[model samples]
Target chain A: MKKYIWDGIFKNNPVLVLMIGLCPTVAVSTTVQNALGMGVAVLFVLTMSNLTISLLRPMVPESIRIPIFIIVISTFVTITDYVMHAYAPAIHKNLGIFVPLIVVNCIILGRAEAFASKHTPLPAILDGIGSGIGFTLAILGMAIIRELLGSGKLAGHIVLGTKFAATPILFFSLPPGAFLAIAVLIALTRLRK
Target chain B: MIRMIRSLVLVCVVAAGLLSWVYLFTKDRIEEDTRQKVRANLVELLGDTTLTFKPVIPDTLWEFYRDTTKLGIIFRSYGKGYGGPIPVLVALSMDTTILAIRPATPAEGLKETPGLGTKVTEPDFTNQFKNKKPSQIKLKKDGGEIDAITGATISSRGVVEAVQVGIAKYLKYLR
Candidate 1:
């Protein structure tokens, strides 16, 4: 059980190692709050989808499993989107289309096909949580770096102090900055091995 | 094949049923949230909570009143932004000078590049429009009084032009 969770956070780290679902990771990592919001949303969807798919494995025909997985995933995504919009309007607005775009996130679909379809509900859920954590940690790390350097702030507060001389690197706040940060992260993870 | 189709249909039926349930649960709250957001933005733009707004063009334009006295008018405008059209709400006093301005919330389709183009929605940018005549709406580069946001020239220009065009089209309704 521990191994299942460990593999996702370290061994099969979704963003750094597996390199899936990079779209939202890069797009929403511009702010720490956005990164956290996306992370929680992905975690909920991933866990629920994995559990549902695993339970339905016995009944779902192999020929149409892909469509079934999609239906399940999109249903969860829409629910998350609605709930976020209703309750957390600020985060929902910041997340924008990315919330609905969660339906296309390959991590959820990839897990459904490669792991959940074969595993039992318990293992499937563990795997979901593991991968979700891996994704959250990777994106959160990137957000901290980008937000701090790009805006000279942490989670929207100016932490660097007024005496700091150098101007915030605007490049770190742009798309190119996301690529550079992710590349450095990938390189660092590789170096650890 | 029949079995495959049967299972697919069954899965879809179940999924649809579940989605409808969730939608029904969230529908009223979502609409209420939207109405509240609009009200908040209206209050912020008009600078008064006590004012009541009535639609002159039904969502396109509205007139704000304070106890039967017409205070000003607010209208919606769109600009061709970096990602797509940016909708702005501009409030004008009875004499037609700008009262205040606001961009659409992200939920209302204000899709601009984050950190750069998105700055147009911030007060530092929107506030520049306040108390200015329509002739002063253009950016400094275009020989107008308003200063454009750094590194966000396109988006800044988009809002400036949107307000310019919106006022041109809607000014007659106020008169």
Candidate 2:
């Protein structure tokens, strides 16, 4: 029971362990604020979609379950998209295309199939939260490293003063830098375990 | 199967209802947000929030005014940038000298390569356009005054062309 929560968070971590949803992880993690925004958005979608799928598991047929799951997940993703666009336009702009692409984010749909459909509603929601946290933690780590080393800023605030801020590594802020940072974090995670 | 169809229908109906509720709830707020944003951008560019905006082409050209006195008209033009269409806002002086150029939209979605072409939205790049005549809006490489961003000459040229062409077309309407 407890393993459901722990596994997704640490042992079977989506980004670091399973390597799912790497697109947004690499793309949006350029800043800590972006990472947190993406994380919260994913968390909401995952939890709601998982809950819906779990509640509908019985009525849904086996052969057509995947499409049904996608509908439920996309419904939640669209809700998140509209809500963010209305309220948090800054984050909405930064996230850009990735916000709509959350429909295809495997973590949301993967949990729906693997856990939500098979489990009861309460446990399914828990699994969703667990996986969401795991994904958030992973991306936050990536963002912290990328923002600090790449741009010398933390959550859009200047941290490195001016001397070091002028010529930040610059490499860490680019796509290659996302790869390098994630790799180092993954390795460190492995070492800690 | 009938069961599958029934289940899909039921789920879709529920999803539609929920989505409609959310959309209806946010429609006015979203519209207000857009209005506020455009108003704020106008204030930032013109340095005056009290000016009245009389739209000549709704979202494209507007005659700004302070009480009954005319200040200047603001023009918005879209440039075919390296990533996509970059929306450049140009506030022209009485003679159409470029008063200021702002990206007018967040450039993140444009997918321009980061650290280079995307810098077009940065004030450091856009500030170069301030007070330049339409003839001088070209890149230094093209014998004009503007300095092209390193490794992003295409984007730099895009902005120049957008402003030059946009200004040329709108200049006739200013009178």
Candidate 3:
């Protein structure tokens, strides 16, 4: 049980160490606030999906279990999408297709198939929370570097200079910035050991 | 056998129940939120507060056509952008002048660096369209007005083109 959590959080993070779900991880990492907003959304979906899948494992037949898991995860995603669209439309708009793409996120579904189906419900939930944190940490780290150097702002405020937006090295906020940031973050985390 | 069937039915019911709970809780907030964002966008465009949302149109796709008297307008226009469609709002004065324009999805999901294409959201870029017409619109190189954000010609052009479509529609709707 602890092994699944340690593996998710540090030993094998889905984002930083494993480098999964790279799209939203880098896209929303522009601001700490955005990163956190997206992170919590993923966290909520992952935790609930994991819990529901685990609780239903006993009744799920092997032949149709994958289909059942998808329907369950997507239902939670649609629920999350609707809530975000209503309550946090800005982030909702910003996250865009990636939110729907959560249905295809292997991290959530993979755990459901591998660990949650076999494990006790409590362990599955903890594993979900730990991995959710791991993903959040990776995205937040990318956001810090990106926001600081990309636009020279912390949240939306100018911490570097008012002209930071006008300076060169404008690559920080672009899409490619996400790829490079993730690679560097991955390498740094790799070197941390 | 009976126990297994009962358990599956129980889980399905719980899932349905949870989904309904989520929907009920979200229904009001979602409506209020959209109203709030549109309200903010309208306020930014019209610069009028007391002019309350006159539900001039029954749909979310807000459009207004005025007679001798002025009416409010809210409509969306899409532009060719780097990644995909960029949604732009055209707010108008009944007299045919543009009151304000807001760019949605600045870079159209392109992962371009911030402070570059992202600057399209900045006041300087979007705010330039204020009170301007389609004729006055063009990149500085083309000799009309508004300078393109450096290293972001595609994004700048997207905003320019989106504004043009909105104006054309606004004109047609008035006529």
Candidate 4:
């Protein structure tokens, strides 16, 4: 249980470790709000897909299983795309194709292939929720740092007073900023280990 | 033999059942979502409270919005941006006077540079394009009109140029 739940949080965090789904990670993380929106979206899709895969595990033929998992994930993504478009156009616009791209997030597919097929429904769902939360926390952490340094304003609101927000460090908002931030955080994490 | 056929039929039925379940759940929403997106994009680029917009026009081309009497302006603005193309829709008052400019997609290549290129979507930048004539739309470099962004010359210039070309095309057709 611990391995299943804790692995995603840090030991095998998707963004921090495996580093799949970097596109959405960077794009939707412009603000803390967008990051939360995307994090929730990922959490929902990952959990639902995991649960469904586990429930259907017994009968799925091994050879054709990848296709089955994909279909299940895509269906959830479409639902999210539609729902977000209708209710949350801002987040919808922000997320863009990266939302559809979730159908291929290595974490979701990895869980399906690695755990869901062999696990029971409850454990699979728990594992999904746990890992999804881990992913959410990881992305949120990245967003906080990026928003702080890049925009000098977290979530579009003026943080650190208006003065600093107006003249944020130039490089933090660039591509190199993202790479540098990710590198430092990972390196810091390793030192802690 | 009868039992084997029944089992095979059962598996096929299950597979079909799952497929239909997902399809039924996702179909209408996807279409509705697209409709909403196009509408929002039109609004963002066009900014007319009265006109209704449609996405039937070619990509980065016209956004169709019609008032009660007849069809309204065709949006025609886009720029070669830092990462990619920044497309916009310009509305007119039928006499070729400006009506609105709704910015659509920001350049696609700016994912890594959101702090910079993403600013292209800002109202401050988009607002400058509104109410200006094609002749008055060039960047400060050409000595015609708009101000280039302080740090992001490429993005600033792209928006100005897109409006310049788009207005020229739209005005010709409107006349």
Quote the TM-score that chain A achieves in each candidate.
0.98, 0.97, 0.92, 0.93
Q: Candidate 2: how large is its RMSD?
A: 3.3
Per-residue lDDT tens digits for candidate 2, residues A1-193, read 7877888799879999888999999999999999999999999999889998999888999999999999999899999988998999889878988999999998888888888999999899888988999999999999999999888899988898877788999999999999999999889988997
Question: Candidates 1 and 3: which is better by lDDT?
Answer: 1
Over the stretch A108-191, how does candidate 1's per-residue lDDT look in tens digits?
999999999999999999999999999999999999989998988889888987544158888999999999999999999999
Residue A148 of model 1: what lDDT?
A: 91
Weakest ten-residue segment in model 1 chain B by summed lDDT = B104-113
Whose DockQ is higher: candidate 1's or candidate 3's? 1
Q: Report clash pairs, candidate 2.
A: none
What C-alpha lDDT do the candidate models reach, one value each? 0.91, 0.87, 0.77, 0.71
Model 1, which residues run further than 4 Å from truth?
B55-58, B79-86, B94-175
Model 3 chain B: ten consecutive residues of lowest lDDT: B59-68
How far does residue A21 in candidate 1 sit from its true spot (Å)? 0.9
Model 2: reference contacts kept, as a fraction: 0.76
lDDT of 1 by residue, B107-126 (tens): 57789888899999889888
Candidate 3 residue lDDT tens string, A93-114: 7777888888888778877888
Candidate 3 global TM-score? 0.73
Output the number of the DockQ-best candidate.
2
TM-score of each: 0.82, 0.84, 0.73, 0.69
Per TM-score, the best of the predicted structures is: 2
> What shift in Å separates residue A80 of candidate 4 from its native position after superposition?
2.0
CAPRI-style docking class of model 1 based on DockQ: medium
B-chain TM-scores per prediction: 0.80, 0.81, 0.76, 0.67
